[model samples]
Target: MSLRETVNSVDTNAKRQACMELINEDYNKLGQYKMGEVQSRNIMIIGRTRTGKSTIKLLLMDPRNVPDEMTLKSGTKDPQFQTFHIQQQEVVLNIIDTPGLFERSNVESDIRPDEAILKGIQLCANMEITKFHAICFCVALTSGINAQDVEAIEKLIAFLGDEIMNNSCLVITHCESKDEEQRNRLKLELEQDTFFKKINPFFKLGVYFSGSLNSDDYKHGNESLKNQYLTISDYRKKLLDLFIKIEKPFPISEMIISQIRQANDSVEQKTVQLEDEKQKNDELQSRIKELQEKYLKEKCLADDLRVKYEQQERLVTDSRVTHGQREGQLKNLQEKLQQKDNIIKRREKCQAQLGNDLKKIIEMEEHQTKKLEDNFYGRLRSVYDADKIRAVFLIPVRRIITDYLRYVITSFTVVK
Candidate 1:
């Protein structure tokens, strides 16, 4: 085989081995890894307050209705982490059901949302987990995303970086009733959201109604719980379907050629991006050279304008100084002329005033005028007798009260 063929063959064999190895880990590990064995994916179910993180965990770990003793003993039913091997695929899943973060009452000063997500990431990283494989951000189907949910999800995306999101899943839990319409609406909303829009392209995303597959009244064999069990089973199958897809080898190979094609496509995309960047850099260099030439021309023009402006300014300043001296001399002459004119006017004004004083004496005699209407009785009442005025005011009030009493008596007969 050619070297390229040999490498492709090796990759195919390695991928097959990885698939087998993952299946083995799921069966033999009993959900607990051997001291040094690695896992395929450690799924951390995270969300804001009461959004079914625990429900997702329970469904994943105990889909057969089997309880994990160690996790049960942990006594944190709401917040838990458990390792389990999924059937068939032998995918060893380390699942964490984190509690409602960003609650005012439940928030711990030390245990922040960042810490929770980072701890999950660290555990996966320590286990030498290359890919998250699947991170189901559990959101309640009944409610839309809140601020805290946004904050926690934002932090998680940042913590896991872009790779995790590419391989992530969105698990909507506690979906209301048999209404797929509501679930569909929620899914539409999530897709439209900016964060999910960015994440959706990378990850396999879908919406699920929890009670649809499992009736709320599920009884193991009992008819009451049977419906509920069926509903649960339905949801379980959905979960299985989701994780199975995630646990499958990245860039899956149901057929040999598809895997090769996906690989080729990835390479081609990278190559195109690289070529585009190179083109952008060359364009930027050309633009920069053009700008530099234009800048030099502008600088030369600016220098010439500055020299011309400075020479003109000097000429203006000289002219302004000479004009100012002439203006000052003219102002001095005008001031002397104005002073003489003022003295002459002052003498004329004084002579006119002496004549005006005598005319005022005659006008004052002619200007005397008066009105002569008389009110003879007005002077008598400035201080009237206080008793008289008081009686004048009290008379009408007394009459009104007397008339009111007479009217009330006439209007209503005595209690009969």
Candidate 2:
């Protein structure tokens, strides 16, 4: 196959996914003659309080510290650690022991197991620890039916999720139970529980009693509990068995002074990325708020302008109405002025006719008077010489008539 086609045929995520799956997969002994340096693995030992976990922890330490049974507390109170090398197996181990599930109270000092587990994981992530091979639970066979056990199991499951739960192992401590039937029944029930349902059966590290280092065995009577404990030889073998059955070790460093370290750089980087995106989202929200404010301001201004424009329009309409009325009034007034002009012209014509009538009357009156005067004068001149005395009296009368005629002529002239 061509190189590119060959690469495409194999899924890289699936290949890396293989890193997630291991059930009795061999953990090769690596040293000067093998792949690299002495390889190490991280293991978690979990269970309820006072389940002989301290005894187990002592046994697992490189130089075992014998825990005084009388001095040992009921609950571990905090997560503990150990570093040891199984020289025969050519492997190193870092085991973690937590105060068993549901042991925490409302007390401030005792944190919830799940929260402690998260804190522990975050610690590992901060230190750049990678890969948790197996999380081994150390349960007490004597008290396997505790109600709190279920919650503890659920918390552990939640802490790791189902994927990593598949790599888990449950080691039944206090294995020397007096009633074999009860132990068997309890084991069966535990196996059927959801905590064990998702896990690989082979990783169930066989029962071993985590007894006190300096105390009497009350279960088996006042003697020591050596038989209940795992000897160094058996411990090494079983631990190696768990390592082989669990997931692969991280490719980097080994023998941490503490707990299981998973590949969490992806999670951390994603957290930072999420924070950055959130910051940007907040900034964008602020900007949107600013824009909305600006838009509201502009809208208010536009509304005011619209109101003013409407007012101006109303004024213009009123002015137009008034102008129409004034125009009509002006037109009516012009019509009235034209009518008055016609009446004045009629009056002037009447005055002119009256003056012509007066002139005709005066001329007719003068004609009449002149005719009368001429007729009288003619009579006098015709009769004057015939009788002297009559004629002498007639002469004065004639003179008087002449004078009156002259005066009448002058008066007529003045009247004309």
The lDDT per prediction is: 0.59, 0.59
Model 1 weakest lDDT span, ten residues long = 368-377
Candidate 2 all-Cα RMSD: 22.3
Q: Give per-residue CA lDDT, model 2, range 286-345, as digits (tens).
A: 999999999999999999999999999999999999999999999998888888888767
Which prediction has the highest TM-score against the true structure? 2
Q: Flag regions of model 2 displaced more than 4 Å.
A: 1-36, 62-66, 70-75, 104-110, 176-186, 189-214, 217-226, 229-236, 244-416
lDDT of 1 by residue, 1-416 (tens): 89999999999999999999998888686756444443455566666655656666666655545222222122232445577876566667777666556533334343457655544544444444445456677666666665666677677655444445565666676652434565578777787886666545444455554533233233244354444455567777787677666644232213423433454467689889999998999999999999999999999999999999999999999999999998999999899889978976875576467446534643442332101101212332356654564467545555575566556444433321
List TM-scores for all candidates, in order: 0.41, 0.42
Question: How well does candidate 2 match the true structure in TM-score terms?
Answer: 0.42
Estimate candidate 1's alpha-carbon lDDT, on a 0 to 1 scale: 0.59
